[model samples]
Target: AAMDIRTLTDDLSVTGQITQDQLAQIAAQGFRAIICNRPDGEEPGQPSFAQIEEAARAAGIAARYLPVTGADLTDDKAAAFAGLLNTLPGPVLAYCRSGMRSATLSSLAQANQDHPAA
Candidate 1:
């Protein structure tokens, strides 16, 4: 299936689950990094993080697996996601099962960036 990507910012985007075959297309779109926000085995036939990471490498895109569930979207995880955005090459594509979790995490991270703890 084609990627249903939604832009969150110039440097970041969120998408639904991607297949290994989609890596090259993602790369061709000039995305320099990928963040997998979906946990492995969330559903039957979903690709594993290891598999996605390997394919991402082959596509010349850096990949990080930062799996997050609804309950796991804590301040710490948002901080981690913010850290990845600070360090990873862009534009970065983050994905979850339906992209909502990834979008939420990105929003949290961006909010933290805008207003850091004093």
Candidate 2:
């Protein structure tokens, strides 16, 4: 399936299977930041975090790697994601293997931020 890109909120853009070349394309298309949600070493042949980071930097975009595996989306991950979103410039593009995880993480982060502690 083609990669999906969606705006979960005003500041976050989520996507799937973003290549180094595609990162360049996204930069050209005016995206200012890129956040990678897939963990390194999960699957053989997946693009390295360094490769994407280098590409994003060369393209004049800020890059951040949060790297949440399928099993790692706990409260800690959600909190960290929220922290990153609060600091990173938008419109930020976050990606995972299928973008589902990226979108889920972003939504969870937003929810966590919206709710107050008891």
Candidate 3:
């Protein structure tokens, strides 16, 4: 399974689900952090959040889990996503089951912000 990273901003990119082996490639890409938007057990045969997080930590990449079902993207969740984007060290990579959740959250968080406007 190839992890295709799609850049949404200089500091952020979104991608479909990735495997533990891909964490090293992400780190090699110079991404300082990873933001996961998929929930554990949401899909069958998916890696648990703990597995991914541990792999990220071992590779020296910061990791965050902000699961959103995409059925409803509440302001609070979007706000939390924004906060992570603001605080996480730059060049972050976000991923979800299909990448839509990650992309949606990134856009919502960027709304009315100066980061992408500049």
RMSD of each: 0.7, 1.5, 3.1
Can you write out model 2's per-residue Cα lDDT over 1-118, one digit (the tens) per residue? 4447787777888888777878778887678898899988777888988999999899998988898887888778888888888788788889988888888887787777789456
Model 1 worst lDDT window (10 residues): 105-114
Scanning candidate 3 in windows of ten residues, the lowest lDDT window is 109-118
Residues 1-118, candidate 1, lDDT per residue (tens digit)? 7789999999999999999999999999999999999999999999999999999999999999999989999878999999999999999999999999999998888788889989
Alpha-carbon TM-score of each model against the true structure: 0.97, 0.91, 0.92
Native-to-model Cα distance after best TM-score fit, residue 81 in candidate 2, in Å: 0.7
* Higher-TM-score candidate of 2 and 3: 3
Each model's lDDT: 0.94, 0.83, 0.89
Model 3: residues >4 Å from true position, as ranges? 112-118
lDDT of 3 at 74: 71
Better of 1 and 2 by lDDT: 1
Candidate number achieving the greatest lDDT relative to the actual structure = 1
